[model samples]
Target chain A: MNLDFSFFTLNIISNFIIKGLLFSIKLTLVTLVCGLIIGTMIAMMRLSKFKILNYPALGYVVLIRSLPFVMVILWVFILIPLVIGKSIGSENSAYITYIVFESAFYSEIMRSGIQSVKKEQMQAGYAVGLTYFQSMRYIILPQAFRNMLPVILTQTIVLFQDTSLVYAIGAYDLLKGFEIVSKNFNRPVEAYLIAAVVYFIICFSLSYGVKLTQRKVQIAK
Target chain B: MHYTFNWSFFFKSIGGKETYLTWLVTAWEWTLTISFFGFLVAFILGAIVGIFRTTNNKYLVTFGNIWTEIFRNIPLLVQIFLWYHVIPHFIPIINKAPRIVLVVMAIGLFTSSRVSENFKSGIQSLSIAQKHAGLALGLNTLQLYWYALLPQAIRIIIPTLTSEAMNIIKNSSVAFAISIAELTMFAMQAQEETARGIEIYLVVSVLYFISAFAVNLISQFIEHKIKIPNQTFVKQ
Candidate 1:
């Protein structure tokens, strides 16, 4: 019943927890990059005029958005091995699943970002003798990215929180690191408490930075 | 080897017991219960904190800000684990409570931070003139809020609240980690028992999609019904 701070030894953290902290950061970076690239493509497809382009993209986003991220992670974890004829370890599965799952969310942000760019700007690009793709490349995407950067970062903060769920597949995320130390030291309560504090510090500071960026963006407009 | 899909397992009795479909339905009930009750806790706590956020009292504002930051920043899973594993150690009464109660509270506090932000914005969106007009008429701040401000603010933020509602439902799936018999748990258990991971997960996903879509439809209908005419939404 006692809440003890005595159990938190420097030796325990340095030995068992640092690997998980590194892995969590690595997984988050990979997911952000891969999710953004695929999400941008899906956003374009969803915005396209043709049904062939839009329907599948729309369906994918809707379907993924509706389900829980944990479910999707489990599905990929279980099903990927069956398809590939070998078990990809939990880390690889977590990476793939997060990227695929997060693309749905990132695409939504991109879609709104894309929509925020003025129609006149696209017209102006065309008037200046640029092709549609070239204009989008040079004009629209840049503006959209600038406008949506804060929102994108905010979502990435949420994504970072979700990286902890990789614990379901036995992936050594930050939370799992705490669990390991807790079991090893007979201090599940302290471990979880400290874990919460660590996650809170990271996410709070990141989102605070996002709020500042958002204000700057608003001022620029 | 090609995996053969068994579509009939959904209706057929599992090991000569109840149908697999029934098990899922039961699990779905837990999901709904957690989300609905969690939403209630979120809305009530969020409304109070949100009001504090909008107030001129510097101390209350700081307190509200700190509360929101602490809850909003931490992952829900970590919160759930803390509540489930650690809270009982500190609060002896919690040891007697059901795990589901703990799960609901964890999800509620986690969601309250998000809902409070929406509420804060809704309150802020009212034209300053509304506040001035209420003051000019000799109404106290409480009466001004009760009679004029809150109704309008709630109407303005209904759309955002609806999405938050859907979010709570999806997030409730994390309850399975602590062994709540939610949809995710049912799917995982069924998959393991049947070795039909693909089919089980696909069905679970569809069920989740249907439930979320239904909430969206119902909330949209409510928003349409309650909309204040000619009032534009506050731009993000």
Candidate 2:
């Protein structure tokens, strides 16, 4: 079982792996931006005084959190065509699903972040003649965001890892790129080996960066 | 919203062998079995690895760190692929191993890394005074950990560990990639066959939600039962 990675030359890397890497990055970024925005809203809703707002947000988060992420991906893929009477490709479906699915997780993170910001901050904003929204926007959220940046970044790494699951939906993600190259070169084992290495390098470095930021945040405190 | 629902498809048997509901029940059992074994492996091994990292021994600490980083960094899906396809090639004896065994190992190994991280932190989060006090009393390292360290650490870590425990159950769904016919796998298959895509996915999602929620409730109950009464000391 002699391994031959000669097949993964520059040509294959440039064409297949690079393409998949780009999609993975794109999906991660889009999901991060959208998920965080929506997650913040959900977090706020959960924190809200209104029972109508709180219970539904609570239910959504609980429901999404309980199921497997892969099932969410698959459900979105199946549901889109059924509901719309036509199909958006798996990549688009994945975008929608990830934004929806990851919001639950991000919202939980955000809620903790918000809670960490003391009630005094909100009261102080009100004392300064600020409205509810003004207090949230100008006072509460910025501090919460600063505290939660590392946690959110960590979740982004998890999302990056999860983008690989789009392979199940037949999306041309980073793992899919490796699969294609492996098929072309007939080196299944080496492809998988390299793929794992690539994922490890990217995630481990990002996590290391997050650790640095966390330390910096600690020192700032 | 107007699509007709054919809910009875779950009651109809394929080729008079077993109903779709029964088939799904079997699939659910497989999912539970895989998750149970996978979590068992992760919890035990992760605890050991976590302990190794905190120990004074230099080599064990490095080895434990390497183990955690390698498994934690790579996605569980890719790890599953490696266990399913790649590892068997080098080890001929296991090439013929069953799919379920390989899938369990993949999920277990991947989750153990996460579990190990939590354990490391739980142990580290304790005050140095505890260790010093134990040493002062002439407690050996083993007794120190068993009495002074682990009991407290376990309580502190239960909330986080509960999530990891729930995670392995969800992680077990990646076995679908290898067609292990677990809940996720069977859900997709049932959708393709029955053409009642929404209903099938809904039922499966509900099943997953119930199970995952059950784990959370159980952990909460355990946490309540073992609460340290009259806690006056501040945890650092």
Candidate 3:
């Protein structure tokens, strides 16, 4: 088949591509913000001295980590409507699911970061008059967060890429937009190539940013 | 309306005493088969790429980086969709092959990047003295890798490999998106037919959990057994 590639067609597709990119950015950003907050809380709970605080957090991590992200997404989509008596739009539901799923993973990352902080720092903080929570807030957490920045960024990039899976759940993210465009034009190759380029651009830039930040962090240290 | 705890319903679905057994067995078979084949392909391809990435040759290293980045960044679901729907049209010769092959290939390619990274790091961690010793002993490149390097590398990599295996098992669920009738797909189908989504999903989760837990335990045991001795026995 001799295919005619036209400027007008390219222009039209570019608009859809931009929209898809915007949707992807929105999902990634919202999920990161929300997931990080929930993940930090869970991490704190997991790291708590009390068994009552730690065990439930441990169970949450194990259970969520064991199941596939797709299963969790489906469970939320299916169960939410049945149980809550309200329909969640595909886009919102995808964000919600990503937040929940990514939080479990990010919590582990945060817990490890917290654990990596030296015992001396905590001891010194106690040597001063500051309480445990105050010391964590003022000293230990700052160091841990600094150390964790590169890893957290890498995980964020991974989470951003993974947001594409929302396409499976009917969210109109970049990949889903490509699927729609490909079906419309019956040109899956062009559509997919375009999508791949966009994804590569995003991921590559994030990786480069991570490298740059790591160097900066090292120099500062 | 609250979901009543129907003990009989849950039991019948899980025990394989009812019609649900057919779906469960089929799903279990499909999931295991896909994961096994996919892991095999990924291991071979990943090992080659991993070794290539660690080579002194700059071009080969660039190729490895490009390959890993491309595969690792893209969502596996999109890759599967592209393989199933798009690739067949691009290569008319392969139109006769089953879609399952394409799905398997997609999974293998996507996973190879991760496995390759793990293997490359494992191999790179070997001491410079070990490579020198292999060279001094008049071993060829292949022999150096096979006899001197790989044994230790494999020992270091067992934990990572276990996690990768678990990843492949979980990822095989993407096969269901292409109508592969894997465990997840089977559960979805059964749920549709029976309107028992929660019960079927819980059972499916348990199935995945058991296999993943088994892999974890075996890897932990192997890792414990393989700890390097503190005393130096220099090959060089």
Candidate 4:
């Protein structure tokens, strides 16, 4: 098989690659923020003393964890529009789906973090006349957050990698950009190799960052 | 603007007198068949590579790392497409083999990275004393891994392997893009014919959910049976 590498074609692929990387970065950051907020709330509910609060969170985790990410994305893209009586843009819909699917796993991660904190931490805060919520906010959360940083970062890497699935819904993410290039130029190996290298760089950097943060946390401790 | 619920149409779509049931059954069969074969390939290859990963053999360890990096970084769908669309054009002999074998090989190769990681971590978690004991008994490298290291690693890795199996099932959906006639493709075609996209997808989701749940539950049960005492030192 003869392989042709054209400068003009490479330029086009590079342009699309930059756009795809930007979109992936935006998706990853937005999902991390939204997922953290929603996941924190769900973690709180899961750890609540009341059954009413806990069950809903439990239900959410089970449902989300069981459903495939692609199915969830399809559900949001197709069903949400039907249900809400309005058209959601493809990018926004994809972002929403990512957050929704990610929060379940993140919440479980956060819940474990919270549970790993000793009961005395909460008790110590309460003994100083802090409210239950205040104690959790001040004492439990700070420590748990520190302990969970590496895991959270690892999840962020996973989320970053998973952003490629947005290609299913025409989101023009990294994988989709590669697909377009490969299809257009009939150079599947080159296109895929470029995309794979970019992904590996991002994920490997995130993992390395996690290691650094972990060391800093340990040193501080 | 809700679409009317056509119960008969939905039922006929999935349970029709035509090839709907046949397609569903065949799809289920193919999904399970692919998953089992893929898991077997991954398990055997992963075990060897996983052992190599923890070994002092620099060449073996480097090979394992490269394999993992290449496979794990790429999306399964892209890899499946590459294997199906691109690899055949490169290799003439394998290209002549039937499509089913090629698809199975693709799935197996794609899933093996995860299996290798799981197995490597499992082996790493075992204490050095175990290896010492194996050597004390005059066991060779192969014999030590077979008689001592692998048995313990297998127990440690079962839960992880179970999750990997579920992942294999999920990844098998990508095979649909290559016209493998798995469950997801079945749903897609059925939806196109019936124009009931929502219901068809819902059914497909439920099917996947139930199968995944069943696999998880069975694995959990097996894990409980093979519970290794004092193995809690390697906390996740």
Best lDDT goes to which candidate? 2
lDDT of 1 by residue, B65-136 (tens): 998999999999999998988888988799899999999999999999988998899999888888898999
TM-score of chain B of each: 0.93, 0.95, 0.87, 0.89
Candidate 4 clashes between residue pairs 3 or more apart in a chain or in different chains:
none
Model 3 iRMS (Å) reads: 2.2
Q: A59-78 in candidate 1: lDDT tens per residue?
A: 99987888888998998998
State candidate 4's TM-score.
0.91
Best-fitting candidate, scored by TM-score: 2
What is each candidate's DockQ, to 2 decimals? 0.77, 0.76, 0.55, 0.41
Per-candidate interface C-alpha RMSD? 1.5, 1.2, 2.2, 2.4
Q: Model 3, B4-97: lDDT tens per residue?
A: 5442553355444555766687778888888888888899889888988987889989999888888887778878877776666668766787
Instruction: Give Cα distance to truth, residue A172, candidate 2, Å.
Output: 0.8
Docking class of 3: medium
Q: What value does DockQ give for candidate 3? A: 0.55
- Of the pair 1 and 2, which is ahead by TM-score? 2
lDDT of 3 by residue, A1-221 (tens): 33334422767667666677788899889988888889988999998989999999999999988987778877887788787788888787888888888899889888888898888989999999889889888988888778888988999998888877776578777887787777777777677766777787888889899999999877877
TM-score of each: 0.95, 0.96, 0.92, 0.91
Model 2 chain A scores worst on lDDT over the 10 consecutive residues at A74-83
Error of 1 at A152 (Å): 0.7
In model 1, the Cα lDDT at residue A86 comes to 96
Error of 3 at B112 (Å): 0.9
lDDT of 4 by residue, B90-163 (tens): 67676687665766777677678878998889888988888898999999999998988888888878988998
